[model samples]
Target: MAENKTLKVPGATLYYQVRGSGPVLLMIPGGPTDAAIFAGVVPHLTDRYTVVAYDPRGNSRSVLDGPAEDVHADVHGDDAHRLLAELGDEPAYVFGSSGGAVIGLNLAARYPGQVRTLVAHEPPCGRILPDAEEYLAGTEEVYQAYRTGGVEAGMKRFEEFVGLSGEEQEQPQTPPSPEMMEGWGRIGGNLDFFLGHVLRPVSGHLPDVAALRQGPARIVVGVGDASTDRQYAYRSAVALAEALGRPPAVFPGDHGGFVARAEEFAVTLDKVLNAT
Candidate 1:
């Protein structure tokens, strides 16, 4: 069974869960979503490494001390540090997807000693993109669609970008809803945090990645098989791997493939984590 608990950070009450045993593994969930979004993959690995998944402040079970407008990456990163403290401050392996991958990369860059290995899957780092201008423009368009219309419209635009129609993209179930966002009024304060603190600073974020490349710390980039042609994530993964000078390892599914192919993905993930 999974054990749920809370950690009090600078301005947030972070809700996290622990399961399994062995080396610690921290899962950084994607943006606009919570840890529950990883339901399929989490359970499969608990029997090996202890898996810790938590919702960031202003999201699902977590709570914030200040108004949502005060949310920022410093607060979020500090919250992550606090959570690590509760785990005895021992360095742990981290697996992050999308926005969460961005966060983990930030953490690894900012505090290299905190992470043992980082498996960053498809971080949307505009700086690393060959055509960053066009990429940001597309991202802004999606954000506008979400803001002007709603999740449906935003998803529709996203589907179109990835060559999926509404009907084709629609699964039997819905992906987890985003708990906070830039346009939601709740996520307004974090925009500067995400862009300035995380983005602009990312240029020098992790010098240790090079050292890590030579040491026990390994940086693995992951892409999805199903997302090869139409997904920005796959392209991003390829770009990141190129930047890192390493070939990316293909994961089992598309963006959300980890959830649907949890068992197979989890096994592969375990092997990758241990190998690193």
Candidate 2:
């Protein structure tokens, strides 16, 4: 059974879900996605681990105390720390995808003792890549599209920039419930937050190489085997691994592979986590 709960952090009210029973495995989502994105994979790991997923501040069920503003990676990391502390679990295993992976990097760098191992999948740390300027400009272009046209416009540009098409582009997404409509105000409100506050900060933010190198937690950067080399995330993951002095662990599919191949992804994740 899954239990939904909320926690009051310094600047936001975070909503989270907990399921199963065993060692804690916290999953952090990326893009504009919330905790619910991990629903498909939860069942596979429930028997062996207590899976925790939550809405990052200002996204979905998690709301900030004040008006939404540009957020830094460390602030998101701090929120992750608070959530982990609230769970009463220290040294928990963490899996962060996309922007969430950026947050995990900050968490491991700043609060190493709180995480046992951090598997950061395709973090869009654009600054670390060789073509950093170009990628960062692309993110700005995406934001500009959002400002002028709307979420769909921005998403279209984003999809083009990321090279998403065919099955990856056509994959079905779960629609929001009627109840969720109330809190969010409008359908594209979260997209506004992602473009105005999240995209640039996360994608452009540089990870603290020194802090990570000296940190206690084991860090493994991940890239999807099927992710094209042209994709920013795949390149970013490769760059991040180089920065960390380690190789990027290849997973089953592209950026959203965990969603497309949940069962296989879970098995791969289990193997990654258990490896010595």
Candidate 3:
């Protein structure tokens, strides 16, 4: 069983899960995903690492103090910094998926000492891309779609934009286990908040190249082996790595690979973490 805990910080109360026992490895989820997104992989990792996963502020059990507003990467990063601070003084190994990757980068830039190694998986930091404006405008359109027709419309636009739609998306997907399904149930209500407040900010936010490069923490930009270069997030990952003067690390599967290919993803992560 995972130990569930809460930490009050500023306008929100963060809900996080602690599993296994070793050096801390914090997994940060993106969009509507919560601490549970890593459920499939955490068990595989527990033997070697103390796995910590948290629901981002305003998502799932991490409750906002009031009605949600447009949130930024820095705010989400601060929430992570506080969680790490509460966890221990030692810098933690971090893996951030999708939007979580963006937040992780921000945290590393702002407080480099708090993160030892950060594997940022497809951050969607379009601002660093040559065609950044187009992606930014697309995210804005996604937000507007939500405002116009609610979650259904928004997600349809989002999935298509990020290359998560149609027949291909169905293939190579690991069916969610009962635990993951239960986790999704808890996160279902988070979509509106995710679409409105989280998506655009993360998609448009720029990574601090200088801070990350100069920071003591080692940075690894990761992408899925199955992802096409035409995919915005895939390209973003490559671009971020180039800006950092390093090639992107290839993971096992596509964007939601942590879910679909949990076992493989965990093995790859273990190797990456042990490498440096």
What are the per-model numbers of colliding residue pairs? 2, 0, 0
Top candidate on TM-score is 3
Cα distance off (Å), candidate 2, residue 90: 2.4
lDDT of 3 by residue, 66-144 (tens): 9998789999999999999999999999999999999999999999999999999988888898887888888988999
lDDT of 2 by residue, 1-276 (tens): 679999998888999999999888989988788876777777889999899998888898899999989888988999999889988756999999999999999998988999988999999888888778888889899999989998889888888776563434324234433433443453356888988889888887899988988888989999987787777888888988998899988898778777667778899998898888
Ranking 1 against 3 by lDDT, winner = 3
By lDDT, who's the top model here? 3
List TM-score per model, in order.
0.79, 0.91, 0.96
Ranking by TM-score: 3, 2, 1
Candidate 1 RMSD to the correct structure: 5.6
Q: After superposition, how far is residue 195 of candidate 2 from its true place, in Å?
A: 1.2
RMSD of each: 5.6, 3.1, 1.4
Q: Which residue runs of candidate 2 sit more than 4 Å off their true CA positions?
A: 165-189
- Candidate 1 vs candidate 3: which has greater TM-score? 3
Q: What is the lDDT for 70 in model 2?
A: 89
